[model samples]
Every structure is written in C-alpha cells, then in structure tokens.
Target: MACILRGLIRLSGLDKCINLVELNLAGNQISKIEGLEATLQLRRLILTSNKISAIEGISHLSRLEGLWLQDNRLASLESLALPQLAQLPALRSLYLQNLDRLAPNAVCRTPGYKAAVLAALPNLTNLDGERSPAALNYAELAAEYDAFRANPVPPKQWVVPDVAPWLAGVSQEVPMGGGPGEVALQQRHAKLLPLRFGAAPCVSGQVVKVIDECEMLVRVLGEEIAKFGRQAEARKSSAVAS
Candidate 1:
C-alpha cells in the first residue's frame, strides 16, 4: 500500500507499518533520513522539498526500486558512499534533481555525473528521469570511480577550550552565603518586609499613618510568636499527662 504524508521531522512511530510498499513525504522539515529501518518491504520512497542535508540510513531498504530526493540541502555525494549504494541490490531508478548546493560543484555539473552515479550503483538503470546510455563503457566507469575514491575528503574537527578554572574563580566569590549583591538585596527586602497576614507593609500614606501601620505589624508578629510558644508548651504538657 502507498502512504502519502508530509510535514514530519522523523519517522518514529511508523514501525508497525511494515507492509507499506510506497511512502511519500514531500515538503517537510525532515533533516536526516532515518526511522524507517523496519520497513523491509519498501520499494518506492520519495522525500522531496525537505531539509535533508545528507543521504544516510536508506541502505537498509533492500527492496527500494525507485528513490526520489529532489530539492534537498545535500552538499555532496560523500554521504551516499558511506552507506554504500552497491548494498541496495534492488535500486533501479534514482532522482536527485534541483540540488542547488551540489549543482555548483564540478563533480555534479559535468556530463560525467550520470556516469559517476551509474558507477556508484551498477544496478541503477535510470537517474534524474534519464535512462542509462547503452554505449557507456564499464572500464571507464570503474576508472572514474577509482579516481573519485582516491582523494578522500577530511572530516571536520572541533576544538573547545577549558573554561572550568575561570568559572571556578568567579563562583568562589559568590559562595553559599552569597556575594555583595545578595547582602544588598536582603537589606532592600527587609525595608519592604511583608506582613504575616499576606499583605505588604503599608508605607505609602502619611508619616504618622505609616508609623502606626509599622507598630501594628510588629504587635501582630509578637502576638503570633507568643501564641505559637504557648501552643508548643500545651502540647508538651499534654504529652507528659498521656
């Protein structure tokens, strides 16, 4: 059965659809080719108008007859070699049209591109909607493949500096007790202390009213503390009696 879907980042939950023969996911935000490892019966696979940067993880589709990957962000054919196109025994037709990034490269621009792809995958009879030419020599294709593989592209490297010592020095100044900022913040909070009854201390009125409100807040806090102390004493006396 054929399944036409779109706007999927990855193929995570489609493992149960093992019987699916054809799958089309045109115009999606998918970056990597993956999550279809269990679809062994898949023949026709289309992934057009997406953000796929490399061609990986499709070698597992042994039964894939036709593959379409048009208008993607693939930079080169290096990713195809890693998966080994020769591993796909049933691949016949392959489409890689409108690859803006790869089109600029000399390897992709020349007429030898078809020959290169044919050399890469001997089983491929059609590429980019064109049938393989009958007069194409196998010896020449092998030599081309050999020349292509002779100069290997180097993998990119990343170097990260150790900033742990610098971070440690800064952290030492702001230990568990906190730094000067924390002390200043505490003093500010004390000035605008909250009342026990879930209300901010009234400090916006006349000076006399503000002073009265502060005294009232102090009295309420003292009363609450005394009441808590009495309750604790009562609980202790009851425990002794029991």
Candidate 2:
C-alpha cells in the first residue's frame, strides 16, 4: 500500500520492481493513472477515488484482469484503449461508477464517453458491483412513477345549455359559414361551447352570454347559422345530383 501511495505521490510508482499483483491505490490526490506498468503480473487494480481525469494507461496493463475506478473526475473514457487487458484472456470484471461526476450537470453533452467505456472493456460481464447490468436501480424509477401518479390535475367549471346553444348558433352562421374569417371564430366558439354545456361537470353559471352584450351576439350569431345552413343545403343538392 505504501509503495502504491508512493508511486501515486507524484504520478510515479512500482517502476523498479516486478512480479507484483493485486494493487489498490484508491482515495488519493492523484489526478491520473500514471506508471505501475512495471507490474506485468498485476491482475486486480482498484483506484476507487482519486483525481483520474483519463483512463489511457489501462492499455499498458496487459495482465490486468479486474479493475475498479469509481468516484473520479474522468470526463470521458473515449481516449482509452484497453485491448491488452482482453489479450490476457483472464479479464472478467470491470467496475465503473461515479460517472455522474463526469459532468453531473450536462450528461447529454457527452454521449461518446459512455460508448467508449463499454467498448474498451468487452469481457467485463460483471460491472459496478453487479453480476450483470440488470442489477441497476429499478426501484428508484418505480418510485418516480408513483410520484407522478399522485399529482392532481387542475379543476374546471361546467357549461350551461342556454349559453352553448347561443354559441353553437353563432358558430354555424356568419363566423363559420358566412366567410373564411368566420371559420376561425366559429372554431373558437365551438371550443367554448363545451364549457357552457356543463362538459366540465365541476362548476355552474346562471347566465352565460358570448360576451358583454347579448343583443349584438344574437343578431350576428343568427347570420352565421344561416350561412352554414346554406352550405349544408348546397352539399345535399350536390349529393342528390351525383
């Protein structure tokens, strides 16, 4: 352990010796995995917490089989190439955690990093304490669904028939059938009609006028209805002719 820490003290360790295996240099101030390639027989390398910004040195450890590098500042694993580990034919497990620290605020900004990490460690069937990737936090996702179910929608009021009948009359007349300008106006009135007809079934109103004045609304509303009636007659006549 001391030798490993010494090696990481200034990004240099175990260069003089050989025949070493199972080294752990976790929780140090080291910002990268430098040196230690001297340990040709090394199998397990655990560098859980440090300042590892990159994972390029992994390619040098041909004998390395198991690795754990969680809680680091690694922004990306795209530059890393660990083909030598796979050459060992002994590599089985690789742990990668704390990736949330890579760019906790902007994960979507870096998509290639996730792909590179998976590609570099192909034989790694067991990852991040899981015997398989299926051992992830499914319960947390279920909890989110439960929270969404508990949320309530806003309340709405019911519409009266007296108000809707008047509105529908307007929709069928000048605004809807009289000309193109009235088409938009008719659709707007149709939408409001549902509320007037108690479709909301929550609240009720005594008097429902299209707007402030009932007399002007009634007159224009009738004209719209008459126009739509004429279009309907024309359509019926065409159908009969056909």
Per-model lDDT: 0.68, 0.58
User: For model 1, what is the C-alpha lDDT against the true structure?
Assistant: 0.68
Across 32-90, the per-residue lDDT of candidate 1 in tens digits comes to: 88889778999999887787777887878889998887777755667445346678889
Q: In candidate 1, how many Å is residue 10 off?
A: 2.3
Quickly count the clashes in candidate 2: 13
Q: Where does candidate 1 stray beyond 4 Å?
A: 98-107, 133-242
Stretches off by above 4 angstroms in model 2 are 1-8, 82-88, 98-116, 134-242
For candidate 2, write residues 8-104 as lDDT tens digits. Answer: 5445747865777777787677776767778777788877676666665666667777877776665544323355545556667765563333312
**Highest-lDDT candidate:** 1
lDDT of 1 at 10: 76
TM-score of each: 0.50, 0.45
**lDDT measured at residue 205 in model 1 versus the true structure, 0 to 100:** 22
